[model samples]
Target: MNKYILNKQQKLTTEKIRNLADSIGIDALGFADASEFTGYTIRNSRRRDPKLSLPEAETIIVAGFYIGGLTLPAWSNFLYGRTSRLYLSGFFLDVVKPLESIAAFLREKGYHAVVCDSSDSERSVLPLKRAAVRAGLGWQGKNSLLLSKKYGSFMALGGIITDAVLEHNTEEEPDRCGSCSRCQEACPLHALEQPHVLKRDTCLSNFLQIEYFPENAQSVSENRVGDCEICQDVCPWNRKHLENPLKTHMTALFQQKIHYWEDIFYLPNLIKMTEEEYESIFKDLNTGIPYSIFHRNVFLAMERAKKS
Candidate 1:
C-alpha cells in the first residue's frame, strides 16, 4: 500500500511531478515523508529532520542520476590519472541543476521547494541515501552507498524538500545485501571493516579531497587523482553496470568534451598544467577539486607509472 500524507492542499499530483522529472532527465526518483528520521542509526538531528532545512517541508523527493557509463577503461592506466565517474560526469555538483528544475516545478504549482546540494554534506538538507531507501528507490549496500538494482552504486543522489504533499511508497526496499561483504573486503584502506558503515577518516576518497595527502597514500592511491571507487568496482550488484554501462542524457555532453579531458588527465600532461589552465578546463564542470591537490595526485600517479 502507498502512503500520502496531506499537509496543505495538494496542488500537484505525483504523476505531474514524475512526468516533469522524466522530462528533466532524472533516472530514478522517489518520494518520502518529511518527518524526522527516528532511528538508532541516524543520530544527527540536522540530517534527520527536513524541517530543519525547510520548516514548511512536508515531503522529500529523492532523485538519482546514473554515471556508470562515465567510468573509462583508460582510467586504470597509471600513465593517465583517473577520476571518479561521479567527478567525470560532473554529477557531484552539476546534479543540482536537474533537482533544482524539479524544485522550480513545485514552486510554480504554489508549493515551497528547496534543493539539497548533493556535493555539500555539511549543509545538505537530508540524508540522501537514507531518504532514497525510505522512498523505495534503493537500499543502502554494505559499502554505505545507495545501491539501485539497475544503476548499482554508480549513481549520484540529489533531493528536494517541499511543502507539497505527494504520494510516497510506504514499503522500503528490503536489504538485498545478504552475506555480501565484497565492498568491505575490497576497500584498500579497510574503511568498510564494519558492514554498511564507512570509516571516513581512513577512506581514500575522503583523503584526496583534503589539503594534504598522507605519505602512505601514494602506494594505495595508484593512478587515482581524485576519489576512489574500489568498493563500488568489486560489488556484485555493480558488475553488470560496470561491464555494460547505460547512458543518460548527459552522455552527449560528455562525448563532446571528453577528448579535452582525455588529453589533460594524462599524468604527463596534467603535471605540466598551471592553475589557470586547470581552472579554464574544469571551472564549468564544478568538480569540487582544487588544482593543487589534483596536481599533487598527478605527480604521484606519474611516479607510480614510472615504477610500473
Candidate 2:
C-alpha cells in the first residue's frame, strides 16, 4: 500500500476502536506511543516492571469511566454491605469488561493486545495515572488522582497494551489544579506530602486495604477504612459535579441507616462464619479487601463505637 493509503487505514482503525469504546460507556479514550514510557518507573511499588509486563508494546489505549455520584456512598460505607459489594463489583465489571472486549477486537484485527486492569496490584505493570495524562485524558490533581475537566477526579481507569501502531494523542493535559489544597487539608491521615505527591505509607486509604492496619493510622477511625475518599470528597472539582439531583438521590438510597454497633457489625453472624465461609462471601467483591482484613476492619469499628 502507498504511504497515504496506509495512513488512511490506520486513522480509520483508530476511529473504529474509539467508537467501540464509546458505545460501551467509556467516558474518554486516548492513545499514547509506548516508546514514550520506555524505562518508566512506578514510584509506589518497587515490584512493578512495565517492560516485563508488556513486551514490545507499541501503543497504550487508556480508558476512563466517570464514577456516578450515586455510587459514592457505597464506596465510603464502612460496613461493606450489599450496596458496597454491588458498587465494588460493578467497578470491576465496568472497567475490565470493556477492556476485554477492546482487546478481543484488537486481536481479531491481527494485533497482539494485552488488557491490564487498574486494580492489579500484584503485577501492576504500568502507572495508569501517568498513562492517562500522556494520552491527554487529564492532569494529575493535587490529590494525586487523575483529574479530567469533564469528570474531575471521580473516575476509574484501565488500559490495553498492543503491538498495533495506533495513532497517538500529541496534546498533554496541563496542570489546572493550581494552589488547590482542599484535598490536602481534608486528608485526616495527612497523606498528601505536596501537590501531586503522596505519602503512600501513611495514607489511610492504603492502610485500610492492606493485610494489617498501620500503627500510625491508629487515630483514623475504623469507619473511615476501605477506600477512604475524604480527599476526593472535599475537592471543589468533585463537589461541583456531585450536586446533580440524580446523584443526590442515589447517595441517599445507600446512606448508612444502622446506628448501633451490633446492627452495623452483625457480630453474631460474622463470628459464626468459618474462615472458608467468610472468604467465599467477600473474596471477589473487592480486589484487595480479603475476608480477614475486612473482618478486622469491622472489629475495629465496633471497638471504637463501644468505647465512645
lDDT of 1 by residue, 1-308 (tens): 44554444453467778888899888898988888887626576477788888898878899988888786667867788888888887776656777777788788888898788777565577788888998889899999999988889888888888988788768798888999888999888899999988888889988888876777765799889888999999999999877878867766567676677787788888889999998888887687788888787788888889999
Please list all clashing residue pairs in model 1, or write none if there are none: none
By TM-score, the best candidate is 1
TM-score for each model:
0.93, 0.79
Clashing pairs in 2: none
Per-residue lDDT tens digits for candidate 2, residues 1-308, read 11122377778889889999887767789988675454445555522334455677777889887664434333344443322222343454335676788889889998888777666465344578888898889999999989987878877788888887788888998998888799998887788967788788878767766875776675665454346667777887777766652243223433443232224335435545566875665454445466677667666665654565
Best by the lDDT measure: 1
Worst 10 residues of 2 by lDDT: 80-89
Give the C-alpha miss distance for residue 210 in model 1, angstroms: 0.7
- Model 1 RMSD in angstroms: 2.2
How does each model score on lDDT? 0.82, 0.66
TM-score of predicted structure 2: 0.79
